[model samples]
Target chain A: MPRLDWEIYEMIERNPFFKHIGFELVNSSEEEILLKLSIKTDLLNTNKTLHGGVHASMLDTVQSIALRSLYQCPVTAMNLDVHYFAPANTGHLFARAKLLQKGYKMAVLEAEIIDENTTLIAKGTGTYKIVRNA
Target chain B: MKLPVTRSTFFEYLGFNSTKTDTFHLDLPLQAILLQDDGTVHPGVFSTMLDISMGATASLETNSFATTIHLNVSFFDLSPKENYHAKTNIVNIEGKVITAEGIVYGQDGAVAAKAIGMFKASPIKQ
Candidate 1:
């Protein structure tokens, strides 16, 4: 792992929201990144299943992490599209993100959330704007 | 509208509060626990807030439980802020399917994010 990668990892580890959600970095590389979250009582929705927001949150984080792994500069999320496939009520959930397009001032990424059984729970794609420091 | 009695634990965890109005409006007080590394509010925070508020709107409109089928959100700003407010309204309802739109405002009242979502409404059991 490069020094920048370690920096990005440390940054993620220090994020308060990341800690609040109890997300763990399962794997990371320039090619892709994976994050895991264990379903807890506090993460459930009115349906007693994992909240759709959790899926969106995790997908957003994974894609942003994937982007930062490739480019160390600061980036901000510009857009996100999420599709929910099925409900997740138990066990751990995994999210994997891959960069789809890296542009001069913007980047696009896609991610999928799956259960331990590899059942797809949700899918998302995001566009982020690269900040050049105004 | 008769809302579901079951409390959404995740929504509580996010610390969102609804206004007294009949519409689906929510406010999230800025907390250190919701900030990103750069001190700006996390994008996930916006998405989660919008998702819940918008879905809640759809549910309230139909008087049934709602599940998100698809959600699209656009972020216009992510500057460090004090708090956020989100409001949602039903766009259309056809049978069991509902479409809604929501907007999130930053502390300064600027548009922070916009979202549109589709939800499947399931009749709440008596």
Candidate 2:
């Protein structure tokens, strides 16, 4: 298991929304970050499947985490595009993210969510602005 | 017009409230649990609100259930830890597919984010 940077780990641990959603940090490396969430009743939509918001949230977080792994400054999401391929109704879901481009002030990343069966549930691409302290 | 749709537990968990008058609107109280490290409401909150509001609007208009196929969100401004409002309108409908657009307003009434969603409509089982 690669050790996560103390600062990044603390940020994730202190985030209240992450706790509210029960997100677990599976692992992290310089190249990527992985997050896990167990499907619960509270995570489902009216159709009894994983809510699109959950997928979006997980994808966004994982991608941001990947950026955090590479930069010390804070990052904010500028845009997120998500496509749902299948519905996940049971078991655990895993999200993996990788940085695709790192520019002077902006970064682009891609993330995907898969079920325990390795089924592609959803995928997203996000652009984030790296906030530099003056 | 009331939408014949069942509320999702995830929606309730986010503390989002919905109303339909001239259009579909969703309101969210920026709770402590929704804030990020920068004291700004997480973008996911806005995305979720838009997705739900737009999907609900599509479903209500089509008289069926709509599932999200694609959602694209552009964040124009970071929202403070304050109340937020979202309104959605159907852009077009073609057979089983519906396209909708939504805008989220921050406490200061500034446009926080804009979203376009495509959903697949399915017949409501009687």
Candidate 3:
């Protein structure tokens, strides 16, 4: 894996949707990444809980970020599966994603979202295409 | 029965306008907020759209609200489509559990994504 660089950090910071959702990268490496999102009223659903789409989006993003950090290349998601365990309404949410496997053209990842009390909110798995060109 | 649409605040913030075009069909106008930095819409946005569309389909078929238990999606290609459409149908309903499938079509008439989900009747609502 290429050494972690500053460009990725800047890319994440500049990502419009990432900022729109307010994801704060806590730590990241080739194998795993941790992201934090402070729950806000805008991010909630009709039930006053974190939106399901937010969980799906964070998992897809964190997994892609982890793969990009590992391969030092851009990637796109090919498929994703999400299972919700609990609903999160308030407090901070954390997402942890790990690269499970990597091939020449594809990578597999698993991720989990949890609340401040460590309650599991959702779990997801995704397959991504490793883009070789820019 | 008309396909259902979500009234969630998140959907509102994303500026997604969903309408049931016909029986078990939903149409959503995509907004710029749902796009990624690279111009393609985010996978999460697709997932959310599919989830709501499929959940609504299940509810309409069963005549009650349903909670999503699991969702699986396969994406094809990303496009700068102005709007997206989804067609959902009930695969089967056995007791309290229901399985449904949906396909998302881009404005260019390409199949952008496909999804199958499992859901159960909402205990709180039903």
User: Using DockQ as the measure, which candidate wins?
Assistant: 2
Q: Report the candidate with higher TM-score, 1 versus 2.
A: 2
Best by lDDT: 2
Pitting candidate 1 against candidate 3, the one with the higher DockQ is: 1
Residue range A27-103, candidate 3, lDDT tens digits: 76554578999988887765566776788888998887788788888888999999988978788999988777989
Q: What is the interface RMSD, in angstroms, for predicted model 1?
A: 1.3
Model 3: C-alpha RMSD to truth?
2.4
Per-candidate local distance difference test: 0.86, 0.87, 0.81
DockQ of 3: 0.61
Worst 10 residues of 2 chain B by lDDT: B1-10
Best by TM-score: 2
**Residue-by-residue lDDT tens digits, candidate 1, A1-134:** 12336778788878999999999998775445779999998998888888888888999898887777777777889999999999998899999987789898999988999999999999999999887663
In the order shown, what is each candidate's alpha-carbon RMSD? Answer: 2.4, 2.0, 2.4
Clash totals, every prediction: 0, 0, 0
Which lDDT tens digits does candidate 3 get at residues B1-126?
A: 454465777767776666664565566787666677777788987888788778777776777766777899999986668888887888999998999998999887899999999877764341
lDDT of 2 at B29: 84
- The TM-score values for the models, in the order shown, are 0.93, 0.94, 0.90
Model 3, A51: alpha-carbon shift in Å?
Answer: 2.7
CAPRI band for model 3: medium
Native-contact recovery for every candidate? Answer: 0.89, 0.78, 0.67
